[model samples]
Target: MKKMMQRDSTWAGIFLLPNLICFLLFVLIPIVSAFVLSFMQWDMLSTPKFIGFDNYIRLFTQDEIFIQVLVNTLIFTACSVPMVIIASLLIAMALNQQILGKKFYRVLIFLPVISSNVVVSVMWKWLLVPDYGFVNYFLSWFGIAGPNWLTDANWSMFSIIFVFVWKNIGYYMLIFLAGLQGIPNSYYEAVEMDGGNAWHKFRNITIPLLSPTTFFVTVMVVIGSFQVFDIVMLMTEGGPGRSTSVMVHYLYQQAFRYFDMGYATAISYILFIIVLILTFLQFRFNKSENWSS
Candidate 1:
């Protein structure tokens, strides 16, 4: 019996060894390296100099562009996260019903979620071109002038937010659908027996039961919105004079364009801290809510 137990333990360690090694090499090491890099002044070509908190201080005090980028990222998160959650929840509820062609509708909605971000950004850029693009041209037919989407300062961020929310809705909708399906039908039946209407079922039962899924989606959407870069980079390149500049794009500029690796890493750590705090708050609130309920 002892020999067989020892054999099983050996096999378990053997199986876990490769994954453990890979995690250390790829994840843990890189994170530590980046943290060390954040405190140094290195321009890739030069020897790194220990700078302590100067890079972080400069981000808050000296770099005005960083402040704007921070605002842009916050705005993107605030707008896109709620829109994605609400829109996806509504779609999920509708699709959860026994409607005709529901499977096809689900497939159609999910198509954009699986599509390449690069391809979508380029396609939308072409479609939104001011003078000769499909969107503006269609608007012209209705006597409505379409604004220059990628170029106009006011519209550029809005365009990115709209696209981000649209692409993400389908993914969150599926998650919500899973949550909705998990909710026992017996609960709804009991509600009906008590003379509760559709609104009552949704308000009293569905909302509370779906809280976990909603919290997950909210955290993910907030993080994803904060880290949005590819589409913004491809579409507007954080251009039209910083109207659509987000943190990651600005970090990319600092790292690659200027070779300020240390400054860029500092920005990355700041972002990490912000996300960590937000996630911690979410977990705390969720625990409290669950306990109270």
Candidate 2:
């Protein structure tokens, strides 16, 4: 028995070794290296010089653009997260009904989730082109002139937020759909016997049961919002004068464009910390809710 157990353990270890090595090399090592790089001034070519806390100090105290980018990130997250959650939930509920061609509708909605971000951004860029774009053209028919979505500073951030929500809502909707399906129909029947309306059933049963899925979607959306880069880069390039400059985009510019690898790494760490804190808070809130319930 002992010999057989040892053989089983050996085979398990052999199967897991490749994945463990990849995780260490790709994820763990890079994370450690980035943390080390955050404290030193290295431009990718020169030998790293110890900068102590200068990078962090400058980012907080002197970098005016960093402050703007931070605010932009917060605004993006705040606007997009709630919208995504609400939209996804509503869509999921709608699709959960016994409607015609429900599967087809789900497939169409989820298509964008699988589409490449670069392609989505580029497509939206063309769609939102000031005068010639389909969006503005459609608005023109209603005699309402559309604002420059990607060009105007005031509208650029909102445009990106809109695109972000539209592109990613499908993913969250699928999650919510699964949550909705997992809920037993007995709850609804019980509510019906109690003379509960749709609103009461949703408020009393669906929302509570779906809290776990909501929490998961909220955390993911918040993290993705903070790391928003590809769409911003492809659509606006952090422009109409830095209106859409997000943390990741700014980090990319610092590291790749300006060649300030250390500063970029520091920015990356700040992003990591911010995301970690937010995610922790979400979990804490979920725990408290569970206890209260």
How would you encode candidate 2's per-residue C-alpha lDDT over 1-293 as one tens digit per residue? 99999999999999999999999999999999999999999988989999899999999999999999999999999999999999999999999999999999999999999999999999999999997999999999999999999999999999999999999999999999999999999999999999999998999999999999999999999999999999999999999898999999999999999999999999999999999999999999999999998
Q: Rate the local accuracy (lDDT) of all candidates.
A: 0.95, 0.96
Global lDDT of model 2 = 0.96
* Per-residue lDDT value at 91 in model 1: 98
- For model 1 the TM-score comes to 0.97
* RMSD of each predicted structure: 1.1, 0.8
lDDT of 1 at 144: 99
* Collision count of model 1: 0
Candidate 2 lDDT at 254 equals: 100
Mind giving the per-residue lDDT tens digits that candidate 1 earns over 1-293?
A: 99999999999999999999999999999999999999999998889999999999999999999999999999989899899999999999999999999999999999999999998899899999998999999999999999999999989999999889888899999999999999999999999999999999999999999999999999999889888999999999998999999999999999999999999999999999998999899899999999998
Model 2: residues >4 Å from true position, as ranges? none
Please give each candidate's TM-score.
0.97, 0.98
